[model samples]
Target: MTYVSVQTQIYSPQGWDLSDIYKSFDEPKFEQDLTGLQQKVAEFQHHYRGQVSQLTPEEMARCLQQLEVLSEQYSYLDTFANLVFCANTRSSEAKQFFNDTKLALTRIYNQLLFFNLELQDLDTTQFDELQASSALQQYNHYLNRIAQFRPHRLPEEAERTRNRDMLTGRFAFVQLYSVHRGEQDYEPVATPDDKQVETPAQLEALLFHSDGDVRYEAYCSLHQEMERHNGLYGFILNAICQDHRIESQMRGYPSTFHKQLLAADVPESVFRLIMDGVSDRIDLFQRYYQLKGQAIGQKIRTCDLNTPWTADDPLLKLDYKTGVQTLLNALKPFDVFYANRASDFFSKRWVDTKVRPGKASGVFSFPTFAKHSYLSLCYTEDYHSLFTLAHQVGRGLQFSRTRDRQTYFNTQPPLLLREVASIFNKLLLFDYLLKEAADDPLRKQAVLTRMLEDQFNLLFYQSTISRLELALHERAAQGSFDHSFVNEQWLEFYRQLCGDAVEVLPEHQYDWAGMSHIFTQPFSSYQYAAASIVSLACYQQYQAVGKDFIPSYFDFLAAGSSMNPVEALRQTVGVDLEDPATVNGAFYYVEGLIDQLQAML
Candidate 1:
């Protein structure tokens, strides 16, 4: 059998032709970027550093405009190089180039470090005076964000010292932790068919196999393999926890996660609601799993939980082109502008969809304004993969529409609102599949089963992750950073959620080891649970208003980070996040879906 190289097909469609972001790594534009950034940084230092408070609003506006332009160019270079490196980590040339570019960007960026610190010192009278200027008024949101840092702002020399210390001291510990995890090799088990596949993805595929013996062995062997490095992993966890504790105290945060929620503009109460709501709804998710167990003809265990409800049809091959087309059709109901952007995404090669070695495991669309608005799936052509495509594109579309209106500083919305568009895409696809599933009832039920399981994974598993993060931070505050303790905490929660419906074996307990998100973004998982609820409400509006809902939806997409999440969402969807009703409505919808699924059963 000839092995087809999926690597060649992973390139962006039009490749460099679509954007000047990088015509080629060898292009003179990169050098131009280096020179241009240096000039901009010098100009920024001259304009803002110690002189910002004295400048008129008009001057500040000009400074911010220049900064925006510089940021766009700088971001394009960084985003493109990062994308290239993401596609192939083995490409030393790309890796080295990215490192060089990043170092250069950081050097340039450090000059503007005083921008926020100085802005924070500006009095309300100065801010009100600045707001009166037409050019500066567009950036009120950005200005307000900087102003909020007043309490945390340190003196200029101290800030620089802290930055230098972080570079040399803080990151070094994280790197050691990463190197230890990277070197820990968990040996793979032999499959029932006697094929050897060693990677995490392949191992996951086996654990989800229809064959119970195969799944059990893969699950047990994998966890047993992980147990060998428990001590080292424990050290890594403690180090990470300690890192957060030190920073939180220095930043004057109440706890480690306090800063994250404050950054997201969400309250701790809202975070608690996500955990409580999902916990109460565990029965609904458990029932779905039990139904999946019946469909797969297996004794449901943590290991066997991933078995496909609908068996693969030998005659059917889900190709890349077909997958893209399915997403196109499912998303067709949106407005013409939205549809056009989606079409451009595929036809212009705006999406990077093929899976390959050294690539990131999960799908996400980056919201860069100048480059690819959304970098999407490493497509596997599986059913779940299709939904991922839809979901990520939804996020990209939101960015594409909104980027034109919002300046760079305002584009990074709170994480809570950031997930709204992505989850909406998922709900849209789920609704479509449930309606148009192949005419056989069993087949339809099978599709629903898959969708429901996917929901549970997002709602329950991810919420569990969020809860674990919450607890981890609490421990970090107490100066306790034990990995084994964290693992035990996870297992206890797993048992609580699964109840007696599924058995989580001791060997299966190291499941947290594989979570890439925990290391990348702290306390980020709960947003998914909130997003699910928000999307359900948004979908309800879509059902009620029909296509008439398109404009406000577009408006929401276009708003970007212009307003606070709650205010922005209210401006678009007219819902209040602080209200218990808004969250309860989401739980109620999940309960209702479970009722529908149960009746079908």
Candidate 2:
């Protein structure tokens, strides 16, 4: 079940093809689509405004069909504008055009939201009758999900006013943070030989450099900028958290974290189970860090987490082509369809792999919804970027296929479900690399080390952050929130999770303001951690059953929204997330990797 190498390793920097989305911003078709969108909005408001609740099932079905089409149109326009602007944040035209496009789209959204607003207002008898209608068979799950949020829906006037204010409220701060940080010049204190100043992604790449000095310099430079603007970022964090608190209070949610769990479509019981299960076994994490610290004769500080512990090798410096080949080969064991789909991403220019100025620092899978997904990464000649490519492509492949098979309404799942493909891909690739590493000790050590590091990051780091987020939100809910309070909570969580082997100080406390999740996106960290743990359980199942599990895995992914995630996992992997034992599965997986690394060392 191994793939033949597509070609020998080759190196070349290539850009993604945006033509599949649009030729350019000035393309006539984009303008025509925009005009059509305006007309459709007006028509919907004209026809379905007051009588939405009384529409026949057949007419409701027609409206649903029309809504899907309009959604696809909005997806295209929004994705295109975002991709264009992210490619060059410095471009004045791009900046202005992106802002304008967002405004237009928002207006359309406000105009058409009345349909769903009224639709969701249907009483139980009305909703039951509508659900029993044959025409709504395909939209059953979507409508049911909309109904599920009945408890959280605000009054129309309150919601509309909040929505109107949000454009200039939280979003304004988010945009300011992005542009303000993006516009700063990174003057590398260590690498003076380089011709031009490096982007944040490039400097981050250096943090993984084999040289300790380079890693230290990059780490210091990154925090210096972050610390310089800590107050503004802290203010943004406070404002966002306060706003979320107010919403939760108005919605009758017990806590902000409770609201987050609902949004993720998971029960609060499972969330607490996962968080507690991880923290209860922090002893293993502490032991791993302690032994590693002893081996390297250095304390495992937060800054040094990304630094390479073992000796450097040529395998670490994989050019983009070789990295692509590795990822393609790694995915082969899944089956030809899965592997070929991934390979096509490389062949079809679906990835933007170059690290250039003004491009965003992180990696992401652009959600084009109906058309296809595109990947963006600031790749350096390192396997970190390669793993990132594999991760993003995994998500892209899933999104592209899911959209093709699903209605527009069901194309995107909750955060937990959406992350499954990407995390599972990385786990598969890691297993493949581990098996391949048997031929070389250095490679084996590096792969094992990387796996352990991922456990720290995905499991421990995320869990700690999520726990701290709970405290932050709760304190804000009680009206005792402040910048100093934020710092104290952060450092306390750091102490709890990092163990005695790692140092935590006041300096590390302020970095919470820099984390985009707690600031811009509240309570999303636990989902990332959950995805990692669930993927580990999934991979372990594959190890137990061999290739027979592939069909079930594929079926689980293809289930789309037909099955709830809890049911999907129960059917496919035989693990119940509500049970605390699932975290033990992740623990078992990591412990085995730790034993191997210790034996090698």
**What lDDT score belongs to each candidate, Candidate 1 first?**
0.70, 0.77
Q: How many pairs of residues collide in each model?
A: 1, 0
Alpha-carbon error at 313 in model 2, in Å?
4.6
Angstrom error at residue 127, model 2: 0.6
Best by lDDT: 2
Whole-structure CA lDDT of model 2: 0.77
Candidate 2 — which residues are off by over 4 angstroms?
Answer: 1-10, 191-197, 313-315, 480-482
Q: TM-score for all predictions?
A: 0.89, 0.94
For candidate 1, write residues 328-405 as lDDT tens digits.
Answer: 666665554455566667766777775444555555666677444746565554565667777777878778777766
Report how far off residue 168 is in candidate 2 (Å): 0.2
Candidate 2 lDDT score at position 253: 88
Tens digit per residue, CA lDDT, model 2, 333-395: 776668877776667777788777777556667777656788888788788887788788878
- Candidate 1 stretches greater than 4 Å from native: 1-19, 24-26, 131-135, 168-196, 205-208, 217-229, 294-298, 310-317, 374-376
